[model samples]
Target: MYYLSSDLFFPSVSEANWDGVLAIGGDLSLERLQLSYKSGIFPWFEEGEPIMWWSPNPRMVLFLDELIVSKSMRNILNRNIFTVTFNQNFRDVISNCQNIERDGQNGTWITNEMIEAYCKLHELGIAKSVEVWQDKVLVGGLYGIDLGHVFCGESMFSIVSNASKVAFIALVNQLKKEDYKLLDCQVYNPHLESLGCREIDRTDFMEMLKGK
Candidate 1:
C-alpha cells in the first residue's frame, strides 16, 4: 500500500488495490480531508491502525431522484411522528453514531481522533448533520460531508424504530428540493441497498463528481 506523510497529495484512484486501500498514515487535517472527499477518496481505519484511504471500484451512491421511500416510511413521514433538523446538533448526532451498538461490530470505527477531525470540518460548514427527535429528545440522526452537489454520508444512528430512516428520507427530500446530484453512501450494505442506494463504477462516480 502507498504510505502518506504531511504532504497535501493523494495518489490516483486507479492505484488503489483490489481491496480499495489507497494509502496509509496520513493525518486527518482539514485540508487533507477536504482533498480526500473532493478526490473521491475517504479515510477508514481502526483506532490503533494508521489512517487508511480508500477508493472502492464499485462505489455505493444514491441518486436524489431515485430515493426509495417505502409505503411504511411515507406513512411515518406523513404522520409527523418525529422532528428532523439539519446541522442543529452535529456533535451529538456524530457522538450517537459513534457510541450506538450495531450487529456484527465489536467496536466503533469513529475513534476520538476521527470524531475531532470531522467535528472540526462541521464547524467549517464542510460537514453536516441531521437530527431526529421524539418528545423533544434526540433519538436518531446522521452526518456527512457536504460537497455542494454531492453529499458523502459517513454514519447514522437510531434509538427508536425507523428513526434513522425518517431522518434519511427527510434529507433526501431536502436534497432533491435543492437539486443535489448524488448522495455518496460510500460502500454497499444491505441497509443502504434497501434505501435505493446502488453500486456504480468508480469511473461513473468520478464523472459525476467532476460535474459537481
Candidate 2:
C-alpha cells in the first residue's frame, strides 16, 4: 500500500502484502526499473491502472540443473527444426509478446509504454530476448531482465504450438552454458512447473539475487 515518488526508491520486499503488491504509482523510467529489478521488485499492472509493483513470496524460480525437458521437447530440439538467437531481434520479440493473445486475458500487460521502457533496458544490455525462428519466420520468443547471476523472465509468446517452449529451452541451455545461477519466473504456473520451476521463499530468492 506504499506510494512511490520520483526518488526511484522502493520499500523493502518484506513490506509486500499477502498478494505481493508492494506499491503503486511509479514511472517506468530506466532508473526506477533498474532499481526495482535489482531489488527483486517488478511492475505488473493492466492498462488504465497505475503501475503496480510486486515481490511475491514463494517466488517461482528455475535452477539450470533442475530443468525438465520432456521427451517431446527433446525430440523437437534434436530435430533441429528451429533456430534460436539472442538479442538479435528484441524489439520484434517483445512486440509479438505484446500482441499474442492469451487465454483468460482480455488485454496485454506489455503496454506501449512498457515496451519502450524495456527496449531502453535492452539497449543498455540489462535486458535480453530469446527468439525462435522456423524457416526464417519469427514464431516464438521471450524477454527479461538479466541481473548477472539471475535472469528475471518477464513474458513470452508463441504463434505456433510449443514455439515458446522451444525458445525457453534454448534460453535455459544458454544460461547453463554461461553459468547463470537461476531463472526468476516471478510467479507460479503449471506450464513452468512442468519445466521444473519451483517456488522458494522470497527471502531465499532475494539472497540468491545478491549472489549469496
Candidate 3:
C-alpha cells in the first residue's frame, strides 16, 4: 500500500491494490477526510493500526430509488413505531457504533481518534446523522459524510431489533425527497445487500460521485 506524508496529498484511487488499500498512515484531519470522500475514498482501520484508505473496485452503494423495505419493515414504518431525527445526536450515534458488538467482529474499526475527527466534521456540517428513538429513548442511529448528491455511510448501531432498519428507511426516504443521488455503502455485506445495496464498478461510482 502507498504511504501518506504530512503534506496534503493522496495517490489516485486507481493505484489501490486488489484489496482496495490505496494508502496508509495518514492523519484524519478535516481537510483530508473531506478530500478523501470527494475522491471516492474512505479510511477504515482498527485501533492501533495506521489509518488505511480504500476505494474498492466493486464499491457497494444504494441508489435512493432502489432501497428495499420488506413487508414487516414497511408495516413497522407505517405504524411509526420509532421517531427519526437528523443531526440531533451525532456523537451519540457514532459512539454507539463504536461500542456496539457485531457478529464475527472482535472489535470495532471506529476508533477514538476517528470519533473525534468525525465529530469535528459534524461541527463543520460536512457530516450528518440520523437518530432513531422509541418511547423517547435513543435506540438506533447512523452517521455519514454528506456530499450533497452522495452520502458516504460511516457506521450505524441498533440496540432494539429492527431499529437500525427503521433509521435506514427514514434516511432513504428523506434523501429521496431531497433528490439525492445515492448512498455510498463503501463495501459489500449481507446486511447491506438485504437492504438493496449492490456493487458497481469503481469507475462508475466515480462518475456518479462527480454528478455525471
Model 2 scores a TM of: 0.99
Residue-level lDDT of model 1, residues 51-84, one tens digit each, is: 9999998999999877888998888889888999
What local lDDT score does residue 120 receive in model 1, on the 0 to 100 scale?
Answer: 99
- Provide the lDDT at 212 for model 1: 34
Cα lDDT computed for each candidate against the true fold: 0.93, 0.94, 0.94
Model 3: residues >4 Å from true position, as ranges? none
Estimate TM-scores for all models: 0.98, 0.99, 0.98
Q: lDDT score, residue 165, model 3?
A: 88
| Candidate No. with top lDDT | 2
Q: Candidate 3 local accuracy as lDDT? A: 0.94
In candidate 1, how many Å is residue 206 off? 0.6
| Global Cα RMSD, each model | 0.8, 0.7, 0.7
